[model samples]
Target: MAHKLTRLVPVFAVDDIERLCAFYEKSLGFVQDFRYGEPTYYVGLVKDVVEIHLISTSSPNARQPWGSGYLSLLVDQVDDLYRRLKGFDAEIVVLPDEGITAYAIL
Candidate 1:
């Protein structure tokens, strides 16, 4: 018998979940699924099959860094997704063959 894994939801640290959730919804096409806290400090988002969670770092454990992340998301239709993302204000760059190969090698 073999164990199985289900889903991998990445939690993004943020000082303001409202703003971050808005960005994810607007820029990345993710929809808000649920939230937690009085002012909604923690929120969950879903885009197609992929889900993302955002947690606020404004608590007593404020040592957590805010708004700093590096993620490589694997998605279908890379070119179309790239074009859609390019319309946003985010910095978009196309990786050449060497750059992509580097990821593959890793």
Candidate 2:
């Protein structure tokens, strides 16, 4: 017998879970899947087959150091997504090239 892997969901620690979830919805086209806590200390977002989880924390060190981690999303239209990200004022650390793209919501 062999085990099968179905999915991988990355959880992010943020100072403002509500704000970050909103950004993922409005900016990246992700929909709200679920949320925990009255003040929304945790959230789950889904876009296509991908899912992301966010947890709120006031600690300044909640998130990993810059460049220490990243999330990669594969979109059908790389150029279109890049343009949309730029319009949304996302923190794009790398420009799209050769059918590949990368950006951040920070």
Quick one: best TM-score, which candidate?
Answer: 2
TM-score of 1: 0.68
Residue-level lDDT for 52 in candidate 2: 92
What's the CA error at residue 72 for candidate 1, in Å? 2.2
Provide the TM-score for each candidate, comma-separated: 0.68, 0.80
- Candidate 1 per-residue lDDT, tens place, 4-104, comes to 88988887777778877877798778898998888676789998888888888875533565556565767767666566656765555544364352121
Clashes counted in candidate 1 amount to: 0
Clashing pairs in 1: none
How accurate locally is residue 19 in candidate 2, as Cα lDDT from 0 to 100? 76
Worst 10 residues of 2 by lDDT: 97-106
Q: Report, for every candidate in turn, its global Cα lDDT versus the true structure.
A: 0.70, 0.78
